[model samples]
Target: MTKLERSQIDFSTFMLYRLAEHWGKSVPDTYRILDKANAIDGYLVPCYDMLHTLGSEYLVNDLTDYVREQGICI
Candidate 1:
């Protein structure tokens, strides 16, 4: 993969763990919820440039909002 692609993946993984921790869920569970909502591919990856610059709490909140906006329960 290109360097940029790798960077995005890394950032996405970081956010996944952060969100999982914030939600008191396991990493795998967090990943499943995110995948079910299409947040990883449809939102996170596409918005990586802008998102990677945001703070951790803000990014987690943004992701929480995005997932909820998609009508996901968790």
Candidate 2:
């Protein structure tokens, strides 16, 4: 894959695992939650340019808020 593509994947992976840990859920479960809320594609990936610059805690919190706002209990 191209470097940019790889970077995006890496960042996504990092956020996935980080979120999983933050939410006390498995990676797959966390992924499901985000996916169900459309946070993964709709927000996370699309906002990666700005999201990646934030801290891990902020990212997790932001994601949590995003998911919650989507009306999914995560």
Candidate 3:
């Protein structure tokens, strides 16, 4: 599929997969930290990790990089 078509899909797995593949990062086995939690909880997990452990700026960098590398249109 073309990049435009691929970007139209609503699959978090595929979006993250494309980013990780492009970046050559060791993408985790699972995207969600908590399988049972809601999106707010899941989003907060990463937010907390960045804020306390890696710093908030790193989180912004990560998000920016992910978007740039993934070509995630949504």
Candidate topping TM-score: 1
Candidate 1 whole-model C-alpha lDDT, 0 to 1: 0.95
lDDT of 3 by residue, 13-51 (tens): 443454345445544622332122232233433344333
Candidate 2 ranges beyond 4 A from true positions: none
Show model 1 residue runs off by greater than 4 Å: none
Give the TM-score of each candidate: 0.97, 0.92, 0.28
- How would you encode candidate 1's per-residue C-alpha lDDT over 1-74 as one tens digit per residue? 99999999999999999999999999999999999889999999999999899999999999999899999998
All models: lDDT? 0.95, 0.88, 0.41
User: Pairs clashing in candidate 3?
Assistant: none
Off by over 4 Å in 3: 1-52
- Global CA lDDT computed for model 3: 0.41
Clashing pairs in 1: none
**C-alpha displacement of 74 in model 3, angstroms?**
9.6
- Model 3 residue 25 CA deviation (Å) reads 27
